[model samples]
Target chain A: DTAVSQTPKYLVTQMGNDKSIKCEQNLGHDTMYWYKQDSKKFLKIMFSYNNKELIINETVPNRFSPKSPDKAHLNLHINSLELGDSAVYFCASKLRDGETQYFGPGTRLLVL
Target chain B: QQQVKQSPQSLIVQKGGISIINCAYENTAFDYFPWYQQFPGKGPALLIAIRPDVSEKKEGRFTISFNKSAKQFSLHIMDSQPGDSATYFCAASTLGGSEKLVFGKGMKLTVNP
Candidate 1:
């Protein structure tokens, strides 16, 4: 069984469009995070959720919103996506702070 | 601002050779440091990690050397195999704080057979 999984491994959309990428983890981790890897392969944390509560929002634009309906699910919804938003989005989960984080297979988003 | 800085954006090593990647962090409070390996079309996996308590930690052919005073750490792969070729990212985070990991730019290692 896959430990951490993401939906729509690849996404292609036009500018000004809206899309959502889903993430789920079965490791029973309490902390879930969203990261963006740009073209240069620079990984940066976008948001983090713990027990369905927002813990950290790393100054991401207002167009991006992260929703965690439950402990096992965290989804990223991008509104009015732009070209700069094209990148690989990764979801990670950890059982607790100061623990190992397991990552999902990432979703590649392309905005034309 | 890149909090964690990595050296040698890319490297090529021969099989059975040693591959070294260095990283430095600006935060002095970081307590948890980890090195992640990523293959093509895959997510980054934790290869090895070391905290400040121990100067070095080894897991098979993978080793992590850390220096708390210098705030620097490095990953050494011994007898690197072709399968070891991938992108390596060094990350640092204060587990006691927000637990947000700050990653380096990433270094691509190509092991030639």
Candidate 2:
């Protein structure tokens, strides 16, 4: 069984469009995170949710918002997506705070 | 400010050779260090990890060597095979902080048979 899974492995949309990516973890982890990998392959943390609480919010633009309905799911919603938003968005989950994280397959987002 | 810095952005190794990737962190507060491996079109997976208390940890052909004093760590792949070709990332995190992991740029390793 997949410990972490993401829906819509690939997303292609036009500018000014809003889109959402869903992530789910079955490892019973309390902490879930969202990371963005740019074209240079530089991975940076965007947000982290622990037990449905927002624990970390990096220097991301306001257009990018992360919502966690429960401890097992964390979804990313992008508003008025721009071309610069084109990158791979990854979902990761840790068993607990400050522990190893397991990543999902990743969703490739391309904003035209 | 880049907290973690990795060296040799790309490397090529022959089969049965040893591949080494180095990383240095500026934050002394970081206590947990982990190495992740990623293949094309996939997310990275944790390969191994180490704490500041230990100098080295080994699992199979992959080993992590850490130097707390120098604030440096490295991942060594022994007997590297073609299947081992992938991108490796080094990350660090603090204990009580936001628990946000700081990742290095990443190093692409190509092992040729």
Candidate 3:
């Protein structure tokens, strides 16, 4: 079974369009996170959730918002996407707050 | 500022040779350190990890060496094979509320047979 899974493996949208990516983890983890890998392959943290509680909120733009409905799911919504929003978004889960994180197959987002 | 800094953005090593990647962190509160390996078009997976209390930890052919005072750590891959070629990332996190991991720029390793 895939421990961490993300939907929309690839997303191609036009500028000013809004899109959402869904993520789910079956590892029974309590903490979930969203990370963005830029063109340079630099991974940066965007948001974090622990048992459905928002924790770390990085300097991501207001257009991007992370929503966690439950402990097993964390979804990312991008509003008015711009060309710079083109990158890979990854979903990860950890058994504990400060332990190892298991990542899902990233979703590549391309805003034209 | 990037909390965790990794060196030698890319590396090439012969098969059966040792591959080394280094990292450093500025946060004194960082208590946990982990290394992840990622292949093309795939997300990274944890290879091994070490805490500040221990200086070294080994699993299979991968080993982690940590220096608490200098806030430095490294991953050593013994007998690096062509299949071991991938991107490796180092991360550090401090325990508080929700431990958010800070990752460094990844290093791409190429093992030539």
Q: How close is candidate 2 to the true structure, as a TM-score?
A: 0.98
Cα lDDT tens digits, model 3, A1-112, are 9999999999999999999999999999999999999988898889998899888899889999999999999999999999999999999998764478899999999999
Docking class of 2: high
Q: Indicate whether candidate 2 or candidate 3 has the larger DockQ.
A: 2
RMSD of each: 0.7, 0.9, 1.1
Give candidate 3 misplaced runs (Cα > 4 Å).
none
lDDT of 2 at B90: 98
DockQ scores for all the models shown?
0.88, 0.83, 0.78
- Residues B22-44 of candidate 2 have per-residue lDDT tens digits of 99999999999999999999999
What tens digits encode model 1's per-residue C-alpha lDDT throughout A18-108?
Answer: 9999999999998999999999999999999999999999999999999999999999999999999999999999977446889999999
> In candidate 1, how many Å is residue B109 off?
0.2
Q: Model 2 over residues A1-112: C-alpha lDDT tens digits? A: 9999998899999999999999999999999999999999999999999999998899899999999999999999999999999999999998774478899999999998
Estimate TM-scores for all models: 0.99, 0.98, 0.97
Local accuracy of candidate 1 as per-residue lDDT tens digits, B1-113: 88999998999999999999999999898999999999988999999988899999999999999998999999999999999999999999988679988999999999999
- Ten-residue segment with the worst summed lDDT in candidate 2 chain B? B93-102
TM-score winner among the candidates?
Answer: 1
Clashing pairs in 1: none
Stretches of candidate 1 off by over 4 Å are none
Clashes in predicted model 1 = 0
Docking class of 3: medium
Location of the lowest summed lDDT over 10 successive residues in candidate 3 chain A? A93-102
